[model samples]
Target: MRLSLEQIIRYQTEGYLIVENVCSHAELQPVIEEIASEIDKRADRLFAEGKLAELYKDEPFERRYSLLHRQCPEIGRGFDIAGYLGDEIFKLLCNKNLIDLVECLLGSEISCNPIQHLRAKHPARGSADGSSAPDYFQNVPWHQDCAVTSEDSEASEIITFWMPLVDATAETGCMEVMPHVFKLGYLNHQAEGGTMIVPEKLPQVEPVLAECPKGSLVIMNKYTPHRGISNRSDIIRWSIDLRYHKTGANSGRSFQPSFPVRSSSDTGSVLRDPDVWRTLWREAANGAGRKIHRV
Candidate 1:
């Protein structure tokens, strides 16, 4: 929805803002059902191929991903936005409320960045202290969105909308961010352990936990340093982070596809068909591969 004056101020000043109830379960249910159907289809294939032991068809969506993961770590291979692109999924991308919130920060013209993700963080499988948890369950390293992009996109302004499909709690590995640091611009990041801010260069500010319920969104600017914690709870933490910038701006990943989803000045450039969106990625994939992140 259109952000309030105070909400805009908070995002501008703090580098991030936790917007609650920007969407309803009704709006997210379609995407959730699509995902569940995809899981069922994959499970059936694996079962017939003798790669999966049980279909687990009766399990609910929240528990199914982790269940399959425990049996086969590669259960979700290549399961990102491109892999899950469909009519329902495309409609969610053009969600009016989400676009409205985006417009408040990014103005009218907007292009959906290729730096999107569908995160199904598996539950921690170690001691309660979590010191021995696997890398899959570890907290994401502190890094800024801009630092991950190519040098050519260093000047472009991007915003991240981290939307969880279910309620997110601090214990369930909700995202956390360093506030009041977006103005500092890109910082030095190390190549080791994922491209992250250098330990010595990380800001000393207290990280704020972006705990919120389903249908809420955790908004952050391009330079905001944020990371998601491990899922200590039993269920998988399902979240999707979508990025957007002004149309025609450097999308950071020239090899992948970026779509014009909204525009005030050039309405005809905005893409609407789900089939076309899928085709764009298909064509990009068929071409030669290139690095998505600089690191």
Candidate 2:
């Protein structure tokens, strides 16, 4: 998964790499099924209890939307992705084809969070004029994840993995990135959710739409200025974003990376050693047990 020589240069220069089809539909089928099944099970249980609608009766749309998973299957706030998505989710998150690319760009000794999150959009009524109504596109505007956290400058040594479960297109609202923006260094994002490029510091390049097919993985430095597209299409746009930090780099957790990355995948570790990676990969195949069918 180590990046190609060109990929490294491109990343250093453009601040992002759009690796197409990092995972195939076949590769992602199991996890997609698992996620959909989880959604159905939770929805069913809540409906049966006659408390689903009442749960958000008093909340605003924004808060209600954000808290949907909370009232169902815990989302974020001490979220352990490995426990939920199971090992394959972690493998997909740490797959060498992509991790190698990340290590090449960010260096070795990586520590990744096991929290895998899904963002989906469904059809709703009377949406904003230009906003994609109903379907929830994962795009959260152009802002760095670090900007929202209390972690200081040193936490910039991180990369993000955005894996889409469906084809990400312009119409469907894929990612839009300002190439080489990171080379200008991290820009200060305004408090009102707007980010601007440093004036004349970096040459301007037209934003590129990251139209990737289902299972494609995009890896980029955390400081890269990027944002999600609004899903104008009726179909749901689903994706999972996984973040990783270098072992010694500041992770915003008191300036120290949290949790040791098992150098091997045997115990669900995502270490950088090649031999360990192979061993763990094989273990994944044998231990996958039965494929979890999608709902």
Candidate 3:
């Protein structure tokens, strides 16, 4: 599952690469089922508490979240990798096929950064006046991965993987990236909606649409400028973002927990227990406060 030399070259030169069919549907079923089960658990409770209208039990996994959200927005909260740390997701973090590709570019040592997130970008209600959707559910503005991290990690080569649980198409609001922008060095960022790259500081270049399919991932360099557009389609656009950097490097999120996922030199450091992962997240949640991520 290691990437070819040419593919690695493209990733270095272009600052991004699309690797399709990295995992089969059978391999993805575990996470999908786990998420579906979570939805059922939450929906049932919300219904009992009179917060939700109906259970929407008949709806499919991809569509159920949207239905539940339409009734009550709380359904979308606290569902990230850090929120629950499910066994399946922790396993996915150490997925062999994924780590092989990561090892190809990052060598044998790899640490899973704590900036992971599962984005369920629901479709925009309508285009007229723009519906009242949360920032997480709305169109993501143009930005670079490096801008979200602290200045301490400005030199770390943090690799990002945006893997869709379902097919991500242009109509469904796939991510668009400015290729080769990494060569421009770090772009100036400001306190915009979400600490985005300054508009006047942007380079004159067109963006490449990353319409990835299920089981596929779009690999990106830390400085690659990218954004997610509005999901105009009928269904939700589901995707998870995972990051890895050289072991012992400052993981942008100093307050969050990072785990050694692959270590050829020291196998003992690689985290293999889901309980430990959950415990680490719980500890972080209790002690971590609102710290200035960017200077």
Candidate 4:
């Protein structure tokens, strides 16, 4: 709960900053109902042990690895959910008031890029958006999330902590930054590798509707050009990004080595790292927690 120098000069001139609540729905509802009931009981026991196609078929790894849950450990999944929501989602993702509002807006000393969690914009309803029957899948085009993968990192001094577990107004689909546009660092768009949405590329940045509320928190900067528009209503946008790093900067990506089960209750024996122990055994078999109780 820190950050305040005019919110670090509006996160360095609108790279992004829309912090509001912080957290308190009884401290984020029992770890989000215990991680969404452990991801709906592993999607119904991997659809009844069919192995849910090992998550998008045979997985050779790369085809955006079938959207690695929205493309790789960006909190997309793989255990370590901030070590299991320990710290109320890590004080709102290392919230020293957003690390002094990202060290006075990228002046120095940031560090928060192991990539946090929460990002469920679901609602694609019965495929083929064939009008009616709970039509979902709203807007999320206009690409620019460090070019999807890692593209090498240092993507012009990263910064994108768009937190929103509720009240993101503008009809459920909030998130439209372009303000000041990260002083024009990286933006030539044409995504395909991981797929978020690109639509060719033209929006010189204009939308800024983040109306926030439920534990609010938004601060863009991965080249200051955002996206995420859909929810149209009926509600269901839930966000919780949290990606910072200036103190030397380069936390671009690193934290995939899990494998050290040993918590008979003493909760110790930490080792995890074999690709985050096989993505925490595939997010605990698609659940995200529970079962790995090594006590």
TM-scores of the models, in the order given: 0.94, 0.67, 0.94, 0.28
Between prediction 2 and prediction 4, which has the larger lDDT?
2
Model 4 agreement with the true structure over 1-295: per-residue lDDT tens digits: 6577787677778767787766666766755655555454544455466544334343322121213333222323443454444434544454445555555556533455555566556433432322221222356655556654355564437667776766787766687767885676666665343244345544555567767787667877776666666655443466677666554434444332222222233334533233444354345433234221111
lDDT of each: 0.83, 0.57, 0.86, 0.53
Residue-pair clashes per candidate: 0, 14, 0, 24
lDDT of 2 by residue, 186-272 (tens): 555554324433334334568788787787777777667777766655455677887777665555533222433434334444454
Q: How would the candidate models be sorted by lDDT, starting from the highest?
A: 3, 1, 2, 4
| Per-residue accuracy of model 3 over 1-295 as CA lDDT, tens digit each | 9898899999999999999998889998999888888788888888989999888788787777887887799877787777767888888888999999999999899999988988888878773324445666677878888877878888888999989998999988899999999888788887867777888988889989999999999999998999998887777788889999999899988888889999989999999999999999888853256564463
Clash count (model 1, backbone only): 0
Q: Is candidate 2 or candidate 3 better by lDDT?
A: 3
Candidate 1 per-residue lDDT over residues 194-220, each given as its tens digit = 878999989899999889799899999
Candidate 3 clashes between residue pairs 3 or more apart in a chain or in different chains: none
TM-score of 3: 0.94
Please report how far candidate 4 places residue 122 from its true position, in Å: 2.4
